[model samples]
Target: MDIHFIKENIPLYVEAAGLTVRIALIGILCAFLVGLFCSMIRYLKVPILKGMVQGYIELSRNTPLLIQLYFLYFGLPKIGILFSSEQCAIIGLAFQGGSYMAEAFRSGLESVSKVQKDTGLSLGMTEKQVLQYVVLPQAISTSVPVFCANVIFLIKETSVFSAVALADLMFVTKDLIGIYYKTDEALWMLVIAYLLLLLPISILSSVLERKVRYAGFGNTSTVSGK
Candidate 1:
């Protein structure tokens, strides 16, 4: 192991790590927004819209992300919808993550009691208002831990972006290995970088899950009082 070379390359690794974090953050944010909207369609139970959202989720989930990336980067350009490699990477990650997130949110929403919706309706709330004010808050709370897990997975999945020559952590690591022929060190660094990112998320998810549980208990108590 070339400790001196590894020390010399610290700045390069930092730059690559930053790019990886940026891409993952942007992709995860887009996925969360899109996924939340898709979950709402399922919650509303609108016939046509629900079907459309289901189709999107199924298609995105069933496909390999590599193929998705290729389609976005190569196929789209042929049809005049051009995108940069970074954009394609982010879009691919977002779509992939969004599909799973939709399922996670759907499961969370389904877990909420139907009585809650009924009570909202009885209180003169519109369907949309009920969903917005009552159901979604609880559903989101229940879903946060699962969504956090998805975020961790999505962070790891950013490695695939290297296929398109994006300068993310894995891509730069591969370049370094090729240049210096230190494959073992490069691989270990990649593993450590992923662990550093993912471990904190796992701990955060556990904490958030406990907080949500306590909040739910508090809400129940308040409702009983009134």
Candidate 2:
């Protein structure tokens, strides 16, 4: 292991780790917004809009993210649509994450039960109002465990963004290995750096899951906090 090399390049690793996190945080945020809107479209079964959303979700979920990134970063130029590598990576990741999130949310939303929706209607609440006031909050809460897992997975998956020339941790680690020819040391560093990024997220997910369990999302007595 090149301990001396790692020591000297500490600042580089730090910057790269920071970039990885920024990309993940922003990517997940964008993904959530996309998922939310798409889930609503599917839930409401909006005619033309739902078809578009379904195709997007299907394609994003089925295709490899690398292929999507390559298409966005490389293929788009063929059509005169140009985006920076950073933009392509971020957008591709966001769209991919959004597909899975949409399904999670859709399941959560529908899990609120038919009786609950009827009850809301009996109380003179419109369908949209029922969703806004009753369904969506519970859906978000119930979906947290899955959502958290997806967030962490998305963070790890950002490693592939290195392929697109993003200066994320994986990219920097690869750069270091290339420059120093210390594959073992660089990989060890990569593992530790990724643990630093993912461990806290795992712990937080557990805590949130526990809270949700105590909330009894599927029970009649417990109401959604959101």
Task: Write candidate 1's Cα lDDT for 1-226 as tens digits.
Answer: 7778777777777788888888889999999988988998887778999999999999999998889998999898888999999999889998999988988788678767888999999999998899888888877776766787788788878888888878777887889889978898787777777778778888887788677766462243222100
How much is 149 displaced in model 2, in angstroms? 1.3
Candidate with best lDDT: 2
- TM per model? 0.91, 0.93
Stretches > 4 Å off in candidate 1: 217-226
Which candidate number maximizes TM-score? 2
Q: Per-residue lDDT of 1-226 in model 2, one digit per residue for the tens? A: 7678879887888888888888788888989989999999999889999999999999999999899999898899999999997788779889999998898788777668888788899999998899898888877877777788889889888889888888878888888789878888888888898888899999999899878766445573333322
Q: Any idea what lDDT model 2 has?
A: 0.84
Error of 2 at 200 (Å): 0.7
